[model samples]
Target chain A: MTQHTTGAYDEELRDLVSRIAEMGGLAEGLVSEAVTGLARIDIARAQNVIFNDHRLDDMQRQVEERAISVIARRQPVARDLREIIAALRVSSDLERVGDLAKNIAKRVIAIDGQFHTKRLAFGVEHISEITLEQLKAVLDAYTSQDLDAAHAVRSRDDEIDAMYTSLFRELLTYMMEDPRNITFCTHLLFCAKNIERIGDHATNIAETIHFMITGEYLQEDRPKQDESSYIPAGYSSE
Target chain B: MTQHTTGAYDEELRDLVSRIAEMGGLAEGLVSEAVTGLARIDIARAQNVIFNDHRLDDMQRQVEERAISVIARRQPVARDLREIIAALRVSSDLERVGDLAKNIAKRVIAIDGQFHTKRLAFGVEHISEITLEQLKAVLDAYTSQDLDAAHAVRSRDDEIDAMYTSLFRELLTYMMEDPRNITFCTHLLFCAKNIERIGDHATNIAETIHFMITGEYLQEDRPKQDESSYIPAGYSSE
Candidate 1:
């Protein structure tokens, strides 16, 4: 009889965990669908993404409110409180991710079926894939409370930044090569940049998770500057 | 003798307010210089903006830290505490404003003596003017604590957004006209978007000031949708 009761309790815990996972999944879906909508130049799909964003917003608020109530009612402590707070922040980030996606979709619709340079489009696609991968990795890290995994994901964001830099240079070259390339390439640049920012936000989520697990802030390190040069004064970074 | 002491204290307060205003002026100078640097494609000017940003950052931190020390030592209450905290947030926002200026300068350097198409160039110049006006208006609002002035600044942000949207469309059109326009216009777009975002952060500062004085958030009211509107279930704004 005791074994039966313990099994039931485990199932309940699993169910709650699954619900959080489902919410994450939905948020991810929203971003992907929005990106796909842009790439395909599917206005209807883009509009759908915009229209459906309210649901994600509502979902995020709901998850946070429910978590808060559960904490208050049960007076959760230790690991339970940590988990609840992490879930709360994760949902919030997810909602922001949705907004970024919506912003891109809105831009795509504004373009009104115009295709920018194919190269620029391809660059955005690459960035989108990298961003989605980061999001997935962070979600996995949060679910498992794996700090090492989260740190790894955080470092990977630098790679995305590097890519963004290279893409920016390439797009600049394209516009210079043909003065006419300014119009379409600019939108492509924004789209790629939006993806890069989304990646940054995902990194932020991972950092928050790392903080929840360990009291230390992950952003404590100063931005890397060349050591061979004289360091600038008055900008004391910890 | 009592009146003399009160007068001296008032003079000290006036000095503090002047210092805050001076910092605000410095922030405006940085942003304007950054924009001018881009228009002229002046690498040296852009580098100067970047180099000087550290000073702004340091001053911001010092101001906030000193404000906290003053509150702790003086045991300020009510309006005094509110004013100090308001200064704290404003300083932080000013630092971010500096960072945004640095970001713009970085874009200018990234362009590396190259110029974008005239159309793209004009787009950035227009947006920069609009952003500068917003920055000026926000600073004035901060100094005066005029809620209506702040609100007017906030409303003007939509105009900035609209200009940004137009710029985005123009850039997209250029890129679509030729794949080669992708490179240079991409950089210009970054510069333009950075200015637009700075306007947004300035608006956020205005909102924070409004909140500090009135203790009410100024966000637009959430719209209620029908049950069939696909709103996330189980969540209420409450």
Candidate 2:
């Protein structure tokens, strides 16, 4: 049965759901703030993002401990078991997302005052916004147990990958154009990579949701649109 | 009390330990081949690394499924529960290690015919070998339940971080010195990052071992040595 015999067990499950939601919110805010920090070069905001990640990490640990405790004590099976598993998976994803955000924030500090290229920052921000939306939607899907929303998030992952490809190309071109831009562009490229990875984590959460609902792993290969990996050394689109 | 009464439960636990060892071996081989491929610019070898990652993925899936099945069916408690949990955590870390290796291999393919600088490749290989050894030691610890070896792996992680920071500087200097070095150095930089991340995953596995044995999360903040984040734009060691 989905409902446990004891009220205490049900209460524990509810706590997991809420904890995941909290973690999601924290992770999302970190991503948004990190990108904002990078785009605006706000050192304090980026440092704040860095400082705040430990909270997410702690919450993730709490979620895992709670889930394991509930499993051993309650012997949950079927949907209840899946719910616990999903909580574990999603919290881990959020923790990784937090790390990605922190990576971005770290680069924000690394490039502080050295960044004069305003135009290059916009593409990074644009991709960040899309990834932020994707992360938000997937987390919402988890709270509502909405399968369709999760699938949509999974399908849209390629969009983030595509944007990251273009951003990678753009940064490399800027670095090539002027030797002075090399250091900043390299840092920006990493920031874009961090953002792109956040999008992958969103897709991972979406897959976790799929597993929770359908009781099967999402079997289709991820439609990866980022071909920057195979881009020619010559930078020719041909 | 350590031994379960049922023959099947003990069998399941043994299977999990063996699977983890198997996954560890596969992950280690992939990392070795990827670095070798990177250093030698061996496209065929890199392609093999990329192709072999799916096997690691499949084994990780089996480890998780089996762990979950045993948990639900056996309702293991205490040490048994921790053992199963360790399997899950280790498999996940190994899967990530596989991904990092595959990423390096992908870059190997990306820069296929263009790579000429030999020195850049050597530093990467040096770091990779150290990280690979750490991974092997950690996996052996996991298999033998040797807490001491795990602790050793955990402590040496900063060495990899230091190497990565220096490599980061080296790549940037090369890029600045000659624009022709930009693309190759950029790719090398990412390869170094992937290796550094593999080190982190090894450290993560070490922490998992600590948790498995002591039944408490390692609460101390990791000794992070990679201060590449704060390295100045001017590339001066000062």
Candidate 3:
């Protein structure tokens, strides 16, 4: 009887992990489709990303429900409890990632035909590619409980931030060069910001993985290099 | 012995709720201070808001730890388990709201002495005021488990969204009118977006409350009126 109970609990835990992996896969797909739609100006693909966000949301609910049920039934302690909590945290992050992707996809529909700049599209595509890689790596680290892999994902977020900063400057210059470019470039700017935020969420998931494994908070401050700081020259409001 | 165990579990649950309330209060204060700092350009106040955000983060960790401990100890089922999960979810939302407020405060430091536009500052103040109201109402609803109040908060998010959309247009116009206004208005734009996002987080809390009370997902689609759809005149990329 005790063996049967242990086997059931193990099965439940495995099922929770598998559901999280499925949710991660869906989120990654949405990110890819959203950015691809932007680069290629594919409204149909963008719409698909937007419509499919509900699936991620549903999956997140399922993960939370299952995790909570397991906690109630098993009364898991210490590391076991932390693993259940981690699933909840990771699912929430994945859901937010999906929402961010949907935000980018919406921009594709919003900026349908104002102006198509291949250079700007290329910049966005490049940033999205890097962010997607980070997201994939973190999700893998999460499933495998690889602390080093998670740390690697956390360390690489600065690259996305730097790319976003340069893109911001480039988009600003484009707007200044042509007033007509303002509308289109502004949409692209938002899309880039959304992708950058996805990178941040991936880093968040990495931290959760570390906490899950160690049952302790990460003591180091997260390395952040978002260059949104706009210090005006010769300005002292103090 | 059973009665004594129940009493102890009740005490733990109560402690979790109290910590969440305390965290909510801090998050609310941070929002108020951050926006007030922006309106007055009070760098000191903004710095305080930024510094205090770490406290909210710490509180979130505490809430999670406490909730997990309770679950492990009591093995709460049904409503009891849901209540613990609600505390965790609410604390997470509150922490994100604190972070959003800090993001706004950081903008205060970023755009220190570039160009202070009284009208723009007033606009941000107005939007922040409404968002603060929504947040307070939602937080109260959460504590009381008042579904109607939660729904009211959700319904009011469109007001914030509409305000944000208009503010975005107004800020874009300001930037276009003068290159000098670019840096300042851009910062204000981001601050406004941050406040708008706080409103969304409040809506998220309301949804969590609904789930906690009903044990089911909110079946209705979230009311979203972020009027960012820009259909340029005479444009068709298809």
Candidate 4:
């Protein structure tokens, strides 16, 4: 009788984990679409990201419902219970990360095709690419339950933030140099900030993974490292 | 035997709701203090908000952990399960609201006392007061499971958004009028946007409450109204 119950519980937990991974995949897709939409300034793609947000919201609900159902039916203890709870929190964060990405895309659309002019200088594009890579890594870390990868994602957040701050200062200079640039530069600044925030949400997912493993929160706060990289459009920060 | 088991399940579910209420109070306090810190441009208070963010994060984890534990131990179904999931989602939203508020305070300190010169004609003092009240109302609506109160909160969010939009336009004008105002106006704009985001988070909680009672998501995405002047300074919005 004991063996039968334990076997049933293991199967249920595995089912729960599988459902979580499926939800994570959907979430990662939303972030990717939203960012790609922003980069290409594709209003259709951006609108697609906005419309698809509801699907993620629905998936979040489904994931939580499944987790709760499994918990109630299976009565998991210790590690399995923590894993399900982490999945629940992760889905929530992932949903918000999707929302933030949508916000960026919306801003991209609202700016009315202005980013196309005067091109990005001072590594904005590189920073965005790195932020996207970091987001992908953290999602990978969570779905795979990798603490080392999670830690690496956490460490990289500061670099994205610093790059963003440098971008902010540069944009401010543009707005200052030509008041006509206010509308466009400010929009880009907010877009960069949105990408930075997406990185923070990714860091959040990693921290949750660390907590699930260690049963403790990671202690270090992400730092704000500033940079003064203002050469020409052709010059790289390196 | 069935009667006794159901009765025990009911009591455990009640306990989950009560714990969620407790966490809600803590989150509300964090948002209140964070905005108050921004109003004063108090660096120490701002730092405190950031430092205490972990507590909000921990509380969120605790809420989900306990909710899941109850589910495992009790095996609740239907409404009982829905209530627990609602608590989980609401707590996550509250934590995000706290993070947004802390971000506002961080912007406050980043401005470093130059804020007074560029104060929006709309006034931070006024917006701060309304925002705190909105936070409180949303928490009350959640804990009490009052859908009417929740709807009312939802209605007010549009107002908050409109106020933030107005502030956004004003800040653009200020930044265009004088380059020196860029840093100061940017910080204030961030603070305004943070407050606006809190209103959205509060609305999310209200929607969750509505969902818990009805099992349906909010269908209408109404235009955000202007709820900023609902209460005169030194009075109440009610």
Alpha-carbon shift of residue A190 in model 3 (angstroms): 1.4
Where does candidate 2 clash, by residue pair?
none
Candidate 1 clash figure, as a count: 25
Q: Report model 3's interface C-alpha RMSD after superposition on the true interface residues.
A: 3.7
Q: Which portions of model 3 miss their true places by more than 4 Å? A: A1-5, A230-238, B1-5, B229-238
Instruction: Write one digit per residue (lDDT tens) for candidate 3, span B107-215.
Output: 8887676566767677789999999999999989988889999999998999999998887777777666765566677677778888999999999899889888888
Q: Which digits, one per residue and each the tens of the lDDT, describe model 1 over residues B1-238?
A: 1122356445544555566677788888999998888787777989999888887767765675465445434444445545665676677678778877887787777665343544557778888888888888888887887898888877777777777766655655565565544445555656776787788767867875786567555753222211111211111123
Chain A fold similarity by TM-score, each prediction: 0.81, 0.96, 0.93, 0.83
User: Per candidate, chain B TM-score?
Assistant: 0.83, 0.96, 0.93, 0.85
After TM-score superposition, the amount by which residue B29's alpha carbon in candidate 3 deviates from its true location, in angstroms, is: 1.0
- For model 3, residues A157-232, the per-residue Cα lDDT tens digits are 9999999988877776666666556667777878888899999999999999999988778874676657764444
Best by DockQ: 2
In candidate 3 chain B, what residue range of length 10 has the lowest lDDT sum?
B229-238
Per-prediction TM-score to the true structure, in the order listed: 0.67, 0.97, 0.93, 0.82
Residue by residue across B1-238, what tens digits does model 2's lDDT show?
Answer: 5657898889999999999999999999999999999888889999999898989889988998899899889998888999998899889899999988988889888887774586767888899989999999999999888999999999999899999998899888888877777888888888899999999999999999999888989964887756677765445323
Ranking by lDDT: 2, 3, 4, 1
Give the clashing pairs for model 3. Answer: none
Candidate-wise lDDT, in order: 0.66, 0.88, 0.83, 0.69
Residue B215, model 4, lDDT: 73
Q: What is the DockQ of candidate 3?
A: 0.43
Q: What is candidate 1's DockQ?
A: 0.08
